[model samples]
Target: MKGRKFSPQKKDRRKAIRSIVEGIVLLTILIVIIRALLPSRGYFPVSEDRNLQTEQGFIAVSYFGVDRTGNKTLISTKRLEEHLKALTASGYVTISQQDIINYYTAGRPLPKKALFLIFEDGRRDTGIFAQKIMEKYNMKATILTYAQNLTLEDSKFLKAKDLKELEKSTFWEFGTNGYRLSYINVFDRHDNFLNQLNTYKFQLVSGYLDRNYNHYLMDYIRDASGIPMETYSQMQERIGWDYNSIEDIYKRELGKVPDMYILMHSNTGQFGSNDKVSAENFKWMQKLFQMNFNREGDSLNTSQASIYDLTRMQPQSYWYTNHLLMRIQDDTGEEVAFVTGDEDRNNSWDTLKGQPEFIKDTIALTSLPGESGLIKLKKNITDSNIEVSVELDGNKAGIQTIYVRADDELEEYLALSIENNVLYVYEKHKGGEKKTIFSLNLELHDGIKPQSLEENKLEAEIKELETELKYVSDVELTKRLNEQLKEKKARRAASVIEGAKEYIPEIGISEAGKRFLKVMLENDEISVIIDNKAVTERLKVSVTEGKGVYLEAAPSKEGYSQRNLTDDVYDGVFKSLVISRYSTEKKDDILYDNRLAGFEKVADTIQKGWDSLINWFIKYL
Candidate 1:
């Protein structure tokens, strides 16, 4: 049987359907491309009306544990509860790292009084004692523990099972103190070769186990033939392995990764580093980790050696009431517990060493000097009115007014005043009740001191002069000059490297290339000229299209020396500049510059997406 022919109308209808389907497909593809190009919205929510100025700063407190009976390494459970109770009564709200970051970076408002609570080294009792107490008060806290300890089946440290259970809780977040928790010899313990091997072996076996791992450890052992000592690269490899291994184990066991890092022994003068090589190694590792968390390294081009300078969570140990009295300056300052009181004499266990059921309130006056009464002594001075000024230690955020009083009475000769970092307190014999007892309380301001019109103008002039002086100072100018010299060297080096790799003929080239080639190859100290422009001063340099090229100078009136490459060199098309090599040598500044340029490109590309996302959220969300 012959099939019936399709009608013209039916054929037209089918064509229309096909066309519509094609149009839909094309439209979907276009939309997807547009979405990909446009940034994703910010994951963090922000407030429309953010008042960073008025928002209270965060106070972070670090606790070891609640040691009932002061057994191993902890305060009594009673003392712990009391401290928590006092903090809660003080109208302070405990916050998370995310909360703090949100307030600082995303303009999210924080509570009027904020605090960060942390427990370190992963004691299992933390879950039993501190966790219950914190939950009772509806507080959140972060726990930091090492990966090595978690792997061990022990009651002393929090085990993998406990961590997994704790991770399920809403009030707690766990982070890494560091893996290995190994004590590094900060001094030259290498004088005894056996001690060095033992330390190395201990660290090696803690996380990774291999019979041949000892052989790898021996690679770092001392040598007599004067092979250059242990280098930072070796240390970086070890540190990297340790961190990666622990993180992997945690991810596998707990199914979660921690974002916070706390320094275990920051005050101990060494953080798992032995000598110079290890120190640098630790610096690099820490920087890498910090950059990973904060994502600031890419933007700031932070030096690895300056990892300590990065904004990180600082530990403040509060063992007593005086320890809680931190003098806050403003929105940006450290929470430091003054180590004034003798913990040996004032700790909860000091009085109740044997009694586990003693009333916590009996030892409530552990840190307040006023409760015990002032110790009587000869004025410690001959003057009737002994006026002395004490300086605030390490509080640099803003101007603060400190109020000092003895008991509840204001002494006739005793007065408190603060001038910047200086704290002035005076005591007189003509006082109503002469007492040496003192307590410090702070009144915080916006940190901006209002100035009169004349004062403002004078100050502005002084700042301007200072700025000018700074630019022209010997050190500043030398830095600028050195940068210019380095740029020249780098550009010269890149040209040499590229020419060498490509085997670009040495005979025929532009006059500029000839000059560059001569200085690089012959080691002649001839000033380089590029594109008929005499580079007597600073000039921008880059490699593009597989060839070295020059860009315009920065928008500055200051003339260039050899060529001072400013930050702008990596902006726009300049970021596309190709860099082939970098080195660990001091003389390889050129290589360093090249690597930095390359890194800038990669970081910028990654950050672009984030920026787009933030902008999208700001606009749409």
Candidate 2:
């Protein structure tokens, strides 16, 4: 049977429709191919800004890692974007290794605000998550890799091929952390000797290896007794071997090693914990690389800084954008435009004292060295029994208090204070009388059992003794340390909690991590839960009629270090604060929730997409 023939007009219409569909598909493919082939051209607003000065020196900032979802150490993509956007908006531009070298060596000028951005550890996740942001901002960064990962088949770390591809992307340049990351002469808090541990083994037993653990090159080759076994020349050779290996691997894999090198373990009196070993490491570093990040915390680098000894600040994942700015300004003595993550979220709260800024999904109630910052959630509720569920930054440095049933005058409230790993249940009213209803030292108190506390004390004692014994050269002090260590060891061995499995933290509250906080106020009684475990079964509180949720951050007298240092500010950040009155009125106030309602979110996303589409068509159509 002959196929039915369409009229010429009908065929033309069908052909035109088919051609349009083909054209769209081809256009999309062409755009993608062009994007892949195009070389990235970084936009330096700082250089373009004639009003800004370029005579000032550059500063380096390093991030440990980045991932889709952030952790205590690794930053999330969203936060990374915020950080980069803020820097770019403030007329800061990323500088390359050559740019820095030129600035120092040739007396060439830098941008008004030059940023030598870095992402250390050569993590695949860091590359995956951070690359888009770098591209988005037209920024460039040096991605540090471990030369040891070159030989290994591990996919967790970025391989040499990955590094080369990253270089091709123009957003990334290659650098080396070291040949390997290892520890030596290590005594854990439990007084267990961990001799020469690799990265995997080190992580497996990381909780124990706190202050006692030393960087592999930080000390001479030591025996189990923590005595240096290596001679001066032998120590030099051992240190040189790792550096040589790093050079060899990079040269073999990626043609030549990148110029930048971040020596592991900072805050060691300029370079290394061991002076002689540091001298050797410094010699090797200078010979191998043009620059070395010899220190962390201080990000500023000037012409006066030694090429072999540079510094950069590694921003922890917990840092608010303002916190980052505070640190940078403190370091460089330059005024920085402090960033408030999302100002629109502030409409729900009243800042009672100090500064309260919204930072992404959290509210940073930041305070100065000796100041207290407080903010109240603006919602009217009459329920006496209400629950405040929050995820706190939970720092050991400052006090993070959850005030429930707070009066409008801010005179009376039931406060659950988390300070220096201790939970203080107290009441505040208009009168001068301040009553402590309950107090539990979270460091001593365990969710499982209290026996673990004694065991921890013994281990901590042993750890202290070991540390003293290692540091003290005096015969008398060493003997005393040994005796104390022996007694602690005996106690630990005799303790019944030795074999018990526990996840007891070194510090109950961490400055770098988030802890779940839930406080339930019931008439005259209040209950507290931290990290989903009951902190107190029953905490008696004064009867409060009003249902006002408040947050406070005060300068901690204890817990974090450098207490004597003046002008030190602490920010107590809290995320996802929700107050629910379950029984009576069922009133719920998501005071600081950053998320929109489901339908609203859908509409927002559609609007954004539509705007983007329209803008793109307008630009290129």
Candidate 3:
């Protein structure tokens, strides 16, 4: 009828069990305390594998030409091929600027080793070289042009036809470095500046400057008196004028306007112009797209917007010969370095006083009339085939028979023959055995029809998002949403092409459009025609993910170094990354010591010990 009286031994056993339980509790608390004491990873996960691929910063390398011997900007063709071979072998994936922008804006994941390759100055040779190399490597590159170099009359520079051809490759996209800004006199005089602005804008509107000028607008902000003349608002007016001009030109020529403007030549807001104007100009440009710095510490927002400046790093010296790797430290403290190629060493252009010795010739290529140039194609039949004519300018060494084929159709035809400087691609009633040829002309506008009904819905949704984003209190969310909207708008803009993808007879054709097709077919080698599909398939495989980090660098030991990055330390770095070219200050201060510190090192050791103890106990039991 009562609780049994416990023996002294039983009482001791109860006490021991209680002691053991207390000890376990203390041990667990101690473990937690130790974990807390270890260095924090901040946003990064303890497991390295858990790190998002997007968190890692990537590199965009500018190229001029491969094997352009003696040209300062040229990387030897052999060296370039070797570099690509190494990059592919080391798991690097070539991506577009759109892909990079999308990743930050939309939280899109990128391949483990993303790279952006840009070719500057719009040289036809460079386009051709890029085509060959890009096809070989299944890589994509941004072909940045200057307005002065883009006339249909130019043979030295890439013309509209060349651009159209290059764009058809699926590996090339067109971006403008500057309009006639490169060719105009951006003097400190007000008249000069005004003239420069009007000229470039007029050039864009008048002719084949089809793409939006993505690079920064370089202007001489100071007056002839060597004083900063323009007030902040005046500077804004001038810069805004330039922006509006370019926008208008793009709208008139390409049927759409550009929301994004890359700062050209300098990183700081006041590069080539007054800092106030430069910063304000960038800010105004952002506002045009309904974006701005409404939040602090938001690197991806307009607060961090800057001119995307690239430099050779070494001035007066042939830096391109040395293999260089330019590293960027992102806001998240992850570091990424792109293999910028042989000329990027030491960022010579950053230190050079005068024009670099490598840039021997800065003259704009003479423009040739596109409509009346070397060749022309008339749309005899809508969207099916065109009549080709060649008006050779005394240089007609290679004259051969012409052939035509549709993209979706397999059958090829002996389209025409060349005599004197003329090409006869008219109807041939009587024909003999002829060669069959595949043409990119047929695929010129494939799938890229005018904005579809769905695009209209997307535009409406984007407008709604824009209104919501304008008043949204959460800055971060606003930015993400804003980026999504920008991306959507870009997609929609892309859909508003003047011509359809693949020959659509429904859309009326133009002589300029026909000529684009003719030039591409003429320029393409037989191998390129056959290998187009295979190259596209290979591009998919070229971007596969792999375990661990991959570092790509050249053999020059002087050009390579490591750096540690932190979130707070990387804000300026991020700004610098976006707008400015490479500088020694950035290399030494920003890019040095970019390693991420997290809980991984400490936690893993403890986890292993705990597991080992448990396993030992199980075995003994």
Candidate 4:
């Protein structure tokens, strides 16, 4: 039987079905392949819950003590003893800086109450005193020193020897405050910035390596010669000594670290050559610490009891010498507490007392032990009642209080809450008396409640990706490579022109020929155009400008000679003929000629002509 002719529509439908089937098969295979390659959902198990409990407490004693002259200093022996007595009496545990650093770095919890003692400037007296007191109290202190002062003779300053001794002690560690105290001044100068930087490096390395090694060793010791002898030094050099830089430097030096850091600053007594506390310098220091500790103000409270408690990790929360108002709300999002700095002693609380609606409904506490100044309020409501909310007028700087009561009987229903913000008091009545006796809202403030590394292989993968991205996206780098290519081409063009220049004079050429040749030889822009353009009818010549040379070329109307001209004229001809005397030094012909050898001799000559023509074209183009 003869095969039946299929209709066009039927054929098209069959083809479409085939395509769809093939697409479906391909898609299915792709899906399977993707599923096989994709990471499994359960590949990584949940990490064990990290202990996020933050024990909030103040550093009881000031990290730096004030001296007799009102200058900040390390705690004197007498003061240290008194502070320690108070700290211990308050049941606080004193830990060293090393302990803190180690515990924090290891991700271990700190003691309930802990304080860190940090001495700046590396004074001999402070160093000696710190060592003795730390030894006595079994505590730790960090000493920040200017490396330049670490000479052997300057025993009055904590020298290299003292650092060595301190390093051996479990209670102390050393940090750099710069090579000299001149980091600030030197950094500010514009003209000698680079020189001062070099000096800083020399000083830093010299302080570290100078005593042990002589000039010979210093010159050859690559690591020991620069201002950036240490990783921290290099970081500081790059990023400067801003607060972020300091924190980053600390981490680089100490490894994975916590928020606490030992910093140095000038004391009042030892204000160096500068007479007054440099507000700028102090601001820098304050910013640095505030950023690191996440504290609010510069006024550091130095209560020995609080310090001991903070150091030991006791009393989970305590106020900083400076306080901040935080917003508080009940489950229902009602405004219950609103405190302002100005209202701490009067005003806001008194206003609440005068409000008849609040006063009649709330009980005024006359003689509630430890609850006198605070106002108390209470009311009977269902389980779904809105909780109190506390709002602050401004950033609250100090503490405030609140009190709540349930019944009319003064003794029956009483709840007290203290906060800088509004306090939500949840209460339940005991018996069926159902007498709404005492209900008072108290404006009071008390603080309470302690509320709560890296895999190298994974890191390597991330770093590799970053490097690849850098290579792909760097425009400047690509431009630089292109520039190098251009330079090489220019040198090659120059070589061909030099050789052709000698031949041109022998060929009985005209004065115009020499002039054209000279101008091409000098212009860089002429050289680039000569190398880039193609020879064609009308000899569509494009010229640009560079160096001091100008290009002028007369086009030959005769096609045959023009063809011959085309063979001799490439980019090199214009590049070599133009005489550019723009550079201070004379152009080196021999070097250019040698590079031109890389290209065909004929092509090279043509390039020079093209270069010259382009130079002239540029003047007109």
Candidate 5:
């Protein structure tokens, strides 16, 4: 066969491409090796004279975990960095377990603004995502582990080897989340008794297990009838076995058990859910460790705290840095510093009411109890046809609103509100009648389909009932649970509702992520999209001219908390507000409110194939 001939230009191009690939590969390998050998303690500097006296005590804050892409509870590395930067700027220094013990037991002085940071769950991703951030901030954090996880070969959780390396890195300290995370004395939402479940089983059936389940160490082992399955002596023996197992795992894996212990669950009565369990856990923890974090949700630990009894506030993934500062100030009862990010962005927003602080890349509009916080962009959208794009990052309990084409006083305007996972569009006329243009129930959003949602829920229920029925030797309970399983399994077939689901677009506007929202006002018609999905085609609007964009946030009717210093205070967080004039008649439809993801996916596939072809040459040539 004759060889295909290439022009001089094509041959030169090929040679250049090959040279670039080889250089990139060699550079990548070199960078990896250099990074491995580098000793990166931390970038945020700590002084040698570390003893600064203060009687105000220290704030202990913990996170569930960190991940590159976060989940419902785990925080993303981007958020963690912002929080650490804010804390560092506010003069908060990270304290170690030894530092905490010295402050509580030896009556030693801690830094005026000290923080005991912790990352729970001991997830491999948590260590991977948080490592660079910790190094960048020069911060120290304790990693809490499940002792049983050390024995498992699952790569989801960190192994003993990873922990040993982390210890060597000097950025991490180890602790225990008891022997494991399991639930006992469990009851489903339907009041179905599911006696006991391991962590894996609990995750497999968590949709059936709401807030009614108890920690394995919290309550006495209960049978299906909710009676104590084991006597007092037997209960103690069972719990002691957990403690012994934890000790044994630590000894086997890391030569000795760590001194830090965070209790398995929340208990207001000193340690466990109740007095008996609390006492048992307290005694065992004291016998095994030097310090125990006995509570969550409140961060302040004073000199009066027992060395064996400490507490840390677990920061939810939804929390802003201000929320943490607000909590710490309240718990410590001290005036604290806050992070005010991007003065230019802050200057652009004018507060109508309440405190509005520009934090990181978002404008944090925090409202006081019983009142609403409102802010408006200084610039007005004068064009009759305009588009507004923003991201709403607020809690489930608050009402966060984006107002477009509103009066300067906001008496008459168009409001798009996200209240308790529902989207509402309203037309307001001050002294006259207010009208609801349309309200959309945001039950299922982007990245989730209606069928997938129902299927997942049903699968969880079936799994729960099946697991329960498998172990239940009781005839009546087993029969009842089996019937429930059958009913759940029957629901696997997706049903069609003849209503407006077709009209409703899959908009991801839930509390899980920073929900992206874009609205278009063409004359008197309003078209809306949320989280890059088309939500509404066109809705009629009464008022539609002259006014600018306004952001308002307030505690929902059910969201108010009586506590003095809590993040329950609503922060109407907004970022990436882009308001511009739009002409539908003249311009081609450029908005990807419907199929942006599809376009990106196709483009990415082509780019990856081209790169793979280049890699083939790099390998075979």
Candidate 6:
């Protein structure tokens, strides 16, 4: 064997080749590792861990009881007590009605574990047994009673004596389930239902007031207090009744003294039944209560001892349809001052024939009927007198007064005052010995602004027109436009194909064909045309590109079948086709380049048609 030695250049080349091969292998491994570690497209990772706290928080349980026949009842005394105990054991706190009202009205936070124990069809069992349990546990519950059911015969149902006894306990509260429990469809007519409800409220509240008055009189007599029997007689006489009027009853019973009011309703009714209490109904009631109490920001606190206590402690009232109205109170048990239906302008005064006069000192003011209607009060006085004024609207009503008195009497006599819509002196005082005495002037306005009927009609018309336009359809017109656009695009594509042939022969056949093919392959618009049935039948060529060289067969005048080639081989064949078609003229090269450029413009035109069609379909179809 002859000994041979390799040159240094050859050895260096060999080393370089080895290094390139190693680099390729390392890069491939790195890519594989990255793909494994990172998330891949269309794949999502989920954790299976179960120890995490997934629930946001617990909502207060709203509880009810049912009888054997599936009718909701409040008759079982023992069972009610057991229910309270169960609720407490579940980490729930018992609260007063006032607390619930206050929490919602003041936008305060509520406990996570709170419950509302509402008893329906106020049975005597509920007042006796449930009251004891509630008191022992310091629990608060609202009992809905059928007013008609409160008779001496049905001891199972709450009677006047039973309700009075319950009230005395401070554990259970009362509300009207309805005047009658069954048979009468009061709620079937909204107006009739409301009227009946108002009647019930007056009867219940008035009864309570009367009993308290009687008790006070009895105590006075027993103690031999100086208060006379005439005073007691006058108080009794004041207790007049007008089932049709809440305002009259309120004036007679309360005498300007603020008190708690709880309205009631039957949880189970004939039409829908208690089982009709779906989740949706519960949500609706929740929102309705919030709105009624003007509780805009937070959940209600249902953990209070009684709805009345909850309401008295808080500065707001809570009302539930077919449930109970909860009034919160203070620690001293003094009822808080509040205006109910009157605040919402849904009081008896709304339908009265004449305005209610509110008089302060020598000045008198009255609110007129009609929405946004103004009621004014004016008084004329001599010079040096001060004037007073007041305004009332659906949202708010207030009064202001002014009076001139001696400098020394300013603090004693000329005090600013406000009471509902009446404004007067804070205290009575004799004028000082100042030589001049000035007269008083006063004026009042009810702030009611009547809306224009014409404006309202026009607004309604505009809304209706807008709704019609929202649903208008133009699908057929859109389809026609899309078809027309497609045809125009096809014609434009044909023009570009015809012009490109002139430049095909300029470059060498292989190079020119390769350039043409590359332009067509890269351009979506041109590629679509080449793939078209008509174009494929008109021109055929075998093209290939390899080792940086392009080759293509010459185009024959006679049509030939289309031939497919790999990318590398096709690049060579396309170059050859371009040279054969365009010749060596510079103009031909320009034409070929320009024709290929037109493909993009054609695609843009087609895309516009697509977008217009899609948008039109979305908007008006």
Candidate lDDT (C-alpha), each? 0.39, 0.73, 0.37, 0.31, 0.74, 0.29
What's every prediction's RMSD, in angstroms?
36.3, 9.9, 27.3, 41.8, 7.0, 38.7
Per residue, candidate 1 scores C-alpha lDDT tens digits across 176-237 of: 76665543321111121112223334433222121221122113433444343556576557
- My TM-score estimates for the predictions, one after another, are 0.39, 0.72, 0.36, 0.26, 0.77, 0.24
Once fitted onto the true fold, the runs of candidate 3 whose alpha carbons sit more than 4 angstroms away are 1-52, 65-70, 182-220, 229-234, 257-261, 269-273, 287-322, 325-621
Relative to the true structure, candidate 2 has a C-alpha RMSD (angstroms) of 9.9
Per-candidate total of colliding backbone pairs: 7, 0, 36, 91, 0, 70
TM-score of 3: 0.36
lDDT per residue, candidate 6, 1-621, as tens digits? 977886999999999999999888557545643442232222111122322221211122222332211222222333344445544554445544454465545544444444445555565534444444555556666665544455436655666666655655565555443334211111110111211112333333221121112111111121123234334334233221111122332234323211222222211221112222222223333332221111111223343322222211111111111001111111122222222212222221122211222111111122211111112111111221221221211101222222222122132322222222222333223443222121111112223332233333333333323333333368875565556545543442123224332211111111111001111211111111111211211121111111111111111112111111001001001111111111112212221111123665688578667545533432343
lDDT of 5 at 207: 49
Superior candidate under lDDT, 3 versus 5: 5
lDDT of 3: 0.37
Q: Candidate 3 residues 442-543, lDDT tens each?
A: 233242334443444455455545655655689899889989888877874324354423222221111111111122111122111111222111111111
Most TM-score-accurate candidate = 5
- Candidate 5 lDDT tens digits, 1-621: 999886999989999999999899767655654453355664343563675865778888899898644666789766888788878877889888888878777887887788889999999878877888788778888998999999988888998999998888888899989888888888765566767788767776764555667888887888878788898888889999999999999999999898999887754647766678778888898799999887776788877777777778877776666666666666777765666566766677786775677744467887653567788778666676877778887766678898887887777888899887788899888787667878876766554444433444555567877766655788988888878777777764443352222222222222343578888889889899987888897788778675677888886655422111234456787765667667666533332121224665588578667555544543344
Q: How high is the lDDT of residue 34 in model 6? A: 42
Q: Say which candidate scores most in lDDT.
A: 5
The residue pairs found clashing in candidate 5 are none
Model 2 scores a C-alpha lDDT of: 0.73
Per-residue CA lDDT of model 2 for 282-394, tens digit only, reads 88887889888877767888878776678888776765666667667767777777665466778777787756777545788876435787887776657777777778774
Backbone clash total for model 6 is 70
Q: List the candidate numbers ranked by lDDT, top first.
A: 5, 2, 1, 3, 4, 6
